[model samples]
Target: MKSELYYNQDRKRRLFVDLWKEQTPFVDNENWTPPPLGSRFHFYVSSRQELKKTFGGWRTNETNYGFNNLSYDYGYYNSNPIPLQPNNDTFKFRLSSYNVNGVYGPIIIDMGTIETLNFAFFSGSGNINSGGVPSTPAFSINYYTP
Candidate 1:
């Protein structure tokens, strides 16, 4: 199976990611886009907390940090909206493990404006006989200013 991803940021500063996917037996393909930013954007993680208690606030080994464990803090990675600087402003974030491909990681995108933004993703791989069949993709965004 293969996949692709896409994202769009409308004038309202909203973001959405879509995914297209196709399998070998199933020649058909489908696309799905995730919700925009600030639409119930929240994260529950414990990587930082795990390392704090295990390693005592020091970077010794990478394995100390695990997933979904109370050893670390479970909070939103980005709960606050990026401040637009004077003259030129850019908003960037790292995306990891959206589906399971492990190929798409950390993408930097420009926050064009405070409007509605959308994005998408597609996944698939085949020969000349088969078209570009991608797996389902998704992305979401949220904004908060202080």
Candidate 2:
């Protein structure tokens, strides 16, 4: 009986790991789209270290629809010599409704002098659809230096 119980536990653990792997995003690819109904996702922006200006937007298909609740946090690397001003090192924004029909936009934002940055996206309650065909949202981040 003990051996049977152990087998069941191990099987459950493997199943959970498989599910997580499927949900994990491939951060290395710029064109990699995230699961449309994912509750949370994050990516690092270290390649555009010299970029001082950044703009980006998101879009979703009709089947996936727009995000009911969305929020994001921006974090910069702390080791950099340049000191980030107040409200520069960390920031968060909430969007109650993001249009699903069209592209969100070329929203400009200050990236500061930080070389490495982390961007995370979170979906609000009832926003994620756990089952069904996985849909990926279209998004982009453009960087520029002056």
Badly placed stretches (over 4 Å) of model 2 are 1-64, 80-88, 101-146
- Kindly list the per-residue Cα lDDT of model 2 for residues 17-70, writing each as its tens digit: 000101243344245354232222232211111111123432221222233343
Model 1 agreement with the true structure over 1-146: per-residue lDDT tens digits? 11223211221111112222211221224543543332212222111111111324422222211111111111122222244222222223233222222221222222122221211111121111001112212222232223
Q: What shift in Å separates residue 70 of candidate 2 from its native position after superposition?
A: 0.8
Among all candidates shown, the one with the greatest lDDT: 2
lDDT of 2: 0.25
Number of backbone-clashing residue pairs for each candidate, in the order shown: 63, 0
RMSD of each: 21.5, 19.5
TM-score between candidate 2 and the true structure: 0.26
Superposition error at 44 for model 2 (Å): 11
